[model samples]
Target: MLSSILTGIGEATQLSALVANLVGVIVGITFGSMPGLTFSTGLILLLPVTFAFDPVTGISLLVGVFIGGMTGGSVSAILLGIPGTPSAAATVIDGYPLKQKGMAGKALGMAVIASIFAGLVSLLLLILVAPLIAKVALQFGSVEIFALVLFGLSTIISVSSGSVIKGLIAGIIGLMAMEIGLDPVMGVHRFTLGYEPLQAGIDLLAAMIGLFAIPQIIKDLPRSQGETGIKIEEKGITNQLPSWQEIKSCFGIMVRGALMGTGIGSIPGTGGPIAAFLSYETNKRMSKHPEKWGTGILEGVAAPEAANNGVTGGALIPMLTLGIPGDPGTAILLGALLIHGLQPGPLLFQNNADVVYGIFAALFIANILTLIVQWFGIRLFVKILQVPKTILLPAIMVLTIVGSFAVRNNLFDVYVMAVFGVIGYFLERYDFPTTPVILAIVLGPTLETEMRRAIIAEGTYTAFFTHPISAVFIFLTLVMLFGPTVKDKIAARRAA
Candidate 1:
């Protein structure tokens, strides 16, 4: 193990690896800080470019992008009050509030610190536990996978953050949307509406772009005439790093967020958003003064920031160990690996030990570089908030349209993006959260396919409860869905 680690370190220190890692991080941060462009979008865009590189170098580059993108989202979320990626949505809750309080520097500093700390913690855990986790994952049957999907879907309650009914509606709509592609078991087309493009279903990229980006574009249009879309003052922003006292106050929050992020990220289909939300809410619950939440506290900024970045390493665990992607970003990373004639699994670990260890080394370096890059480049990113909303919105719209088309070179996807953009706008206008819809879209196909497989294998739905792992997941899912509400009710009754 020591020799392999050293050899991997040597491989990762090569000139190509270093250059690729740096370039990927720069591009990722750019995409992540820009509205309508996510880390996944950036990865998709860079897929073809990586085909020419060797496995170790190529995967290293993508890993750098993954880490950088996750951290970069907080930049825009704090400065502009708009999440550059869905993963950063939780950061916006308190991040922008701090910006409004003329603590933009402090907020961004805390975000970066928390991100680096959580990222390192998760990366270490991944290095130590991924192989063992993969061994266990090998035993997961269709029933277990179905239950896992159910567990992931349980996060809808936390993500909803407002109306459970609307969240459920959005989730159902997202699930129904995925049904347009094809029936996994029967191969029958259900909701194509006679459109050929519908046969392929809505592209995930298009849906993501439309649902998150377009709504922001439309909302910002009305503010184009103003000096800035958000009216927060940005002066006296020097010394962005947090004080020792502040760090001491937020230490527990950061640790908790990191653990939550790492745990959720290891589960396939659960992404940074779930971790971020869970971390934020959990921190709030644990805080001595919960009422002060959403009022620009450093703890709030730290928790979600830590969780989202912690997801970078956590999501990679399953992706590398079981060939199962933890989120869209890892899914794209998996594609990159396959493109280099590399498969991620236990066998790959044995056959390509150097490459595997090289990836670990590169990720460690990338996280360190991310801290340095963001620290130096933050001033420039903050200046983006001063850009006029008119120019910014149009630019963002054009980029999203191009990105939607770029995924499959399909004009149909661009149209799908437009349609969903309209849908997202209305959803937002009506106060329905779009995150649930996006989450459902991501997990819908997996849930449907796995459930069908589980039923076929067991010949009965009740078998889901018979398997110990599946049963545990099912129990957790139920608790996640209703546990908070029940607790709240009990507390209310006691207060009365």
Candidate 2:
């Protein structure tokens, strides 16, 4: 194993491979930090270029892009409350609050550090125990996945700290919005209202941008001239690392996040957003001050950042080992591999161990580079916060509109964004939480599709409760939903 790793390292260090990896990282980060363009889009755009490169160098480039893109999205999520990629949605929970509180540096620092740590942890696991983990993940069926989505939905309680009922309402609204397109099973149009554009469904990126970004812009526009939105001092901007005590405190949360991300990532079709939400909820439940979760807590930044990046390594396991793309990004990576005359699976690993190891080695290097790049460049990113609302808000508005339209080049998506923006503004005015809305938008389709598939295959709903994994997830969902109330009751009784 040591010799193979060294050989892979040697191959990855060649000049062409090194240059390709660096270029990929820069390009990936550029796409990821911009609203609407995701890592998968970047990979798809660059696929034609990789055709001329060797397999090892080509795959290494894609791997670097994958790592850099995941690391970059949190930048915008923290600073602007706009998730550059779907994976960064959970980061916006506490990240924007931290920025508002003059701790943008701390939030970015934690995100970068957590991303690097989780990336390495997942990479190590990918190299050492990928086959074992993949084997276990393969056991999951539609029933288990449905239960898993339910478990993710149950975390809305943790995210919606102050108003559980409002959160549920927001979640329901999001689910209804997603239903505008064709039904997943029947292929029948349910709620298009006869609009041709609605036939394609509400685009998640557009809806998310409108839901999160437009509300902030609207709020900023009404501020008086003398009122400060975020006070920034040039001298105060420092990329100071967290205190050792702080780091020690969060180490466990980071590890748990890494594990959760890796496990979820290895499951095909389940992506980083699910992992990020799950990890965030787990940390919130385990924290002594659960009430502080959405209020700029460091643990809040760490969990999602760690989990999101961890998905990069985890997603690759199934793709490389089983020839199954774990998510859309990996599906593009699979195409890149096939174009290079390399098929990914057991036999490919045997015949082309060097290429496999080279990709792993490239990921390690890419992560290290991401840490360095983000650390030094963070101040520039943070400076966006210092821009006056007059200029900044308008730019954000334009970006939001452009991003919405860019998803599929459909102008109707921009209208969807406007409608969602109005809804989000009203929701915020009424003190309804928006995270649940985003969460529901993300999980609703999966839940409905998987549940339908499970029932059809089992001929009854009993499989959901009879399958051990599915049952375990169901139990966990119940615990997540009701555990806090039970605890409060116990505390009240003790006081009495």
Candidate 3:
């Protein structure tokens, strides 16, 4: 094992690997900081370019992008209140508020720091326990997956800003939106309304952009006439890094977030967004001052940023060990490996042990590079808040439209984005939280598909409770659903 580690370190330290990692991180930050272009999109664009390089160098580049993009999404989330990727959605809850408070630099700094810390932690897990985690992940059947998703859906209560009823209503609307496409279990279409384009349902990325970006753009339109951009404090930009005392305060939150991210990312089909939200929700529940969570707290920014970046390493575990991609980005990474004549299952580990370790070293280097780049880049990133609204709003509007269209290269998605934008605008206008809607859209398909599969396999709903893992999650879901109300009742009784 020691020799293998040495071999891997040797391969990763090569000039080609270092250059590839640096270049990928730079490109990735650009792609991720832009609303609508996700890390997966960047990987897709860069995949062909990687074909020219050796396997280790090429994979290193992709790994760098994966890490950079995961971290970079927080940039737009903090500065503009628009998540550059789904994973950064949770970050916006607190990050943008910090920006509103003229603490964009602080939020951005915390995001970068938390990202680097959690990323290394996950890398450690990947190196030490990949096979064990992969083995356990393989035990998750359809029933278990359904229960897990159900548990995730329960987080709507936490994410909902003020009113739980409004949140549930928004979630139901999101679920209804998900039903518009062809049914996951059967190929039969339900809510297409005889329109061919509707058969594909709503594009998640487009809807997200519309939900978060469009409303903000519209809100700023009137102000475009006379309003200058937000005034950022000069001190905030110059001294962006958090104090050691602040880091100490958030240490536990970051650790918990990292663990949650690693666990979720090891499971195939689950992705960074789920880890991020779960982390945010969990941290909120655990915090003594939970009421301050969405009020631009640094802990809120740390939680989701850590979890999302931690996903990078945890995701690679299943992808490398079991030939199973943990999420869309890793699926593309798996494809890149295949393109390079490198299979990712156990035999490849035996035959190409050096390459495997090299990838590990590359991931470590990528985290360090991401930290350095984002640290210095915070000063530049905060400048976005200085742009005049008259120019900024129009540019953002154009980006939203273009981004919506670019997702599937479908004009219809642009229309979908417009529709969702209007829905989001009204939802926010009425104090209805939009995060639940996003969560429902994300989890709806998985929830539907897994429930159906579980039923088909066991021929009874009771099987959900009969299975231990499923039962545990279901129990947790129940607790999540009712725990707050129960606590409130207990407190009221005591006061009485």
Candidate 4:
């Protein structure tokens, strides 16, 4: 383990790795600070490019983007009262108020500090916790793995946001799409519809680009002017670092927010938005002067910023150790890992400890770089908001097409991307969550393959429940799926 850690450190410190991390951080900040351009979209657009690099370097680039984007969202939340990303929504409550009070610089400074603090804390937890989880997971058989995948699927409820039924429908659609290709075990065509390309199934990268990027472009393209209405005042914004006393005052809040973010982010489908809002609300409730929370206080900025940035490391835990993504960003990262021929799970740690440890080192470097870059380059990152959507969206569209086509150098993949883009646009238009679709697409094959293997190995369906670990996970799945409905019913009965 020590040898692998040392090797990973060596890999991460290479000149190419350093450059990729720097560029990724800059690009991530640009994407996160611009409204309607999310870091997930950035990941999708850049997914194909990573395929050309070695595993460690490519994953490092993505890690840098993930860390930087989480912090960068606070930029617009403070300056324009519009969160650049959903996770930054809570930051706007106090962040904008601080801007109004001509304390924009102070708010921005504290936000950066809080983000750095929380991010490192989450990283430490990740390093300590992930390996232990993987060690336990190493004992899982096919039945247990199948149950775990079922548990992962149950998380669709958490990501659904508004309607669980809609999320399930979307997930079913994704599962059906995966079924179009040749069966994984039997090697027989299931639903090719007489098309040769369909025999290979939908390309993951193409689907990811279409589902995440195109809808965003279609929504933002109608607005010709960008950042023209928002003005950044120069006077109060310069050299507005927070005082040492203020940082000390918010230390407790930052630590609590970090822990909350890490815990929430470790749960599949919860993501940064929930963590940020939960932390912000919890801090408000715990504060002596709750009334001052939304009125522009340092605690307010620190709470959400810490939690949201903390999610960067926390989300990676499940993705790396369990082959389960915690959020859309990590979902794309999972796809990238598969594209590079790296299967995430316990065996990955056993076989490719160097790569796994390299990722840890990369994340550590990325967080430190994020602090330095955001602290000094605030002015440059803020200017990213001014780029017109008319120009930016068109360029992104081109990237999406190119990225999809580059997957296998097939024009058919490009067509598939366009079709899914239309489907995604309508899905989003109807307020249906698209995350479950992505998750299903990523996890469906594993679920199907593992179930078959489990049944074959045990010669009965009862094996899933007979195994202790599998039974535990299956119980969790049942609770995840039906617990909320039952609780709501009981609440209604009590009210009646």
Candidate 5:
């Protein structure tokens, strides 16, 4: 295994693979930073173009785009309160706040550095401990996985950041939303009410688009077209590096975010957004000055950005070692692999070691190009926000249609996008937090699937706590769900 791995590594180190990886990162970043464009759609749009190139070069570049796209989403989320991808939803919380305070440059700097660092850490972990981690991932049975999903669900309280009760209510609403379709296990429809589209339930991506991108558009409108120009300004230079103190202070947060990101990302059906949300909420609550979070602290920028980027590498765990996809983006990645006549599984490392190693190497090299390109490209990116809303909004709506259509080549998704835009507008008007809603969209399926599976196998309730590993996750979920209650009591006692 070692000798073969080395040989594969050697085969993939050529300059062509390196260059393709670098260029792919740049392309991925551009597509991701644009409002309404997503990493998966970006890849889909560009995948056809890759058919003309060498397989290794083409795939390496696509991999580069996927990784870069993850990092790039934070840019718009921080700058224009627009998340370039759904994964950056958590970022928009504090990120948009910083941009509003004219600290956009500082926020962007922190996000970029944290993204690069966490990405490197996840990659290193992948290279050194992937097989070990894969073992741990397998240890997670249905009960354990369900408990983990509950752990994610338990985070809704933290992200509320305003009213815990309201957040819980919102999360419940989201879960209810998730139940709108047929029961996959039972082959029975529950909430569709006989509508053809409703039988499939609400599209998760469309719901996310509603929960995130739509609200921003409604907030920026109602002005005349001639004077509708929103001038985008760079208050400070983009190339500024964050202070050593800032980096040092955020070290623990970054590490924590990265670890958590990797763990969540390894789960099939979850994705970068969940990792980012959990990490951001956890870091914020753990901070000495939790009150300053949405007020635009550097830690706010660093935590979610690093967390999301960490998901980039971790998502590959299941995809490379097992046949399962960690997220929709990886689902698209799986398609790309199939297109190249490669099967992703335990045998992948043995069968096509060069391709796998090439991706690993590409991730490492892409980070360098990503950082350099982003540093120089930040100025131009910031300028994009200056485009007139009349022009940009229409283009965004069009992109929404195009992107949605690109997903499954279905016109229904385009309609789904339009419907969600209205839904998002009203949700924002109510001052409801979308974090929990998006979190539900993310975790709902996993939660239901795991719980049903666990219940069926155990034939008793104790199985969730019977095994040591399952017990640990269950205990953690309990703590996450109820610890805030204990904290509130302690603070009340102290105040009294």
Candidate 6:
């Protein structure tokens, strides 16, 4: 294991690999700091280019992008109250409050500090535990895999705080959308709308962009013509803590958020954004000042920022160990690994130690670099919010079109994206949660593949709950699905 990790590290030090990874990190951070621009989009846009490169360098480049982008999401969320990615949404709920209270600088400071800490903790855990986890994963047959996937789905309960019903509806919609494409296991075509393009099913990227990005942009369109409606109180930047007292009080929040984010991110299908929001709500429920949560508390901003950033490394655990992506960005990383002809499972640690450790080692490097860049770059990123919408909107639109076309060079995807943008806007207005919808799109394919395999093996009605691994997963999934509903019912009954 040690030797293979060393080998992977040595491979990363090659001049070309270093250069490519640096470029990827830069590009990822740029997109991730911009609202409506996502890490998934950045990776998908670059996927076609990897066809011509060494797989090791190519894969490393994308991994750098994923790591950098995950941290970068907090920049906009903290400084401007606009989330650069869905995962950053929880950051916005509290981060913007600090900014409103004339503590934008302080908020960004806490966020940066927490993000770096969380990232390092997650990185350490990944380095120490990945090989062990992969070894355990070897025990997985179809039943275990199905159970793992089911448990991953259960995280939707953690994600949906106020409205579990809405979250379920969103999850079902995502599952239904997944059915639109071909059945991976059976070689059967499912619900294509009888169009040749529809045969490919709804493009996940296009759908995600529509659901998370377009809708938010459209909701803000009314302010597009006005002076960038975001008012910057423009307080001189302060590095002071929100309060020694507040910091001490909120220490547990950040710690809890970071740990929860790390655990959730270790599973495939979930990522930092969901972890952030879950951490935020979880912390709020435990806080003495719950009423002050959305009203601009530093703990609010700090918790999610730290938690979301922490999940970045946690997300990498499964990717590095089992070759399974824990989120969309890592999903792209998986593709990069395959293209390089490197299989990333248990043997990976035994065979590619340098690469494994080099990536792990780079975690420390990237977190340090992220803090350095963000510390000095806050002013520049915040200025983004003040950019006149007339110019910004048109520019964003053009980028949206170009970014979509860059994926497959398909016009069909472009139209799909526009339609989703409209849908996202209306849904946000109605207070429907769009985050789960995107998550569903991301997890849908994995769910389908695993469940079918489990059913095939068991060949019985009880397969879902009979296999020990599957049973554990189903138990968790049932808990996730029913826990909130029961809690809500009990709360209502008491109120009555």
lDDT of 3 by residue, 116-201 (tens): 99999999999888756545655778898788778767767766749989988998988888888898888998989899999988
Ten residues in a row with the worst lDDT in model 4? 223-232
Among these predicted structures, which one has the highest TM-score?
Answer: 4
Candidate 6 lDDT tens digits, 1-496: 5566666677767787677676677666766877766776667555545555666676656766676687778777866778888888888887877777777778877887777778888887887789788778777777777666656555555556557677667767777877786778876688875667877777766666556556544654664344453555556655444567767776787788878888989866567777888899998999887998998778887788778877888988877776556555665565456545666666576676666776775566667766766677666655654565566555556666765555567999889878877766776676666656665665677677877777787786577777676687678778767876788899999999
RMSD of each: 5.4, 9.0, 8.2, 1.6, 7.4, 5.3
- lDDT of candidate 1? 0.81
RMSD of 2: 9.0
TM-score of 4: 0.97
Off by over 4 Å in 1: 1-66, 69-114, 224-226, 229-236, 239-362
Looking at model 4, the pairs that clash are none
> How do the predictions measure up, each by TM-score?
0.73, 0.59, 0.62, 0.97, 0.63, 0.73
CA lDDT, every prediction?
A: 0.81, 0.79, 0.81, 0.89, 0.73, 0.71
Arrange candidates by TM-score, descending.
4, 6, 1, 5, 3, 2
lDDT tens readout by residue for model 5, 360-469 = 77677778778877877898766654555666556555556555565456678667767766766776677666667766765677678778888998888788889777
Candidate 6 TM-score, C-alpha based? 0.73
Error of 5 at 39 (Å): 9.4
- Residues 25-135, model 2: lDDT tens digits: 876776576555576656644554565677777777787789888988997888778887888999999998988888878888899899999999999989987656445
* Residue range 381-406, candidate 1, lDDT tens digits: 65654555677567767877776787
Ranked candidates, highest lDDT first: 4, 3, 1, 2, 5, 6
- For every model in order, what is the number of clashing pairs? 0, 0, 0, 0, 0, 14
Better of 3 and 6 by TM-score: 6
Model 4, CA-based lDDT: 0.89
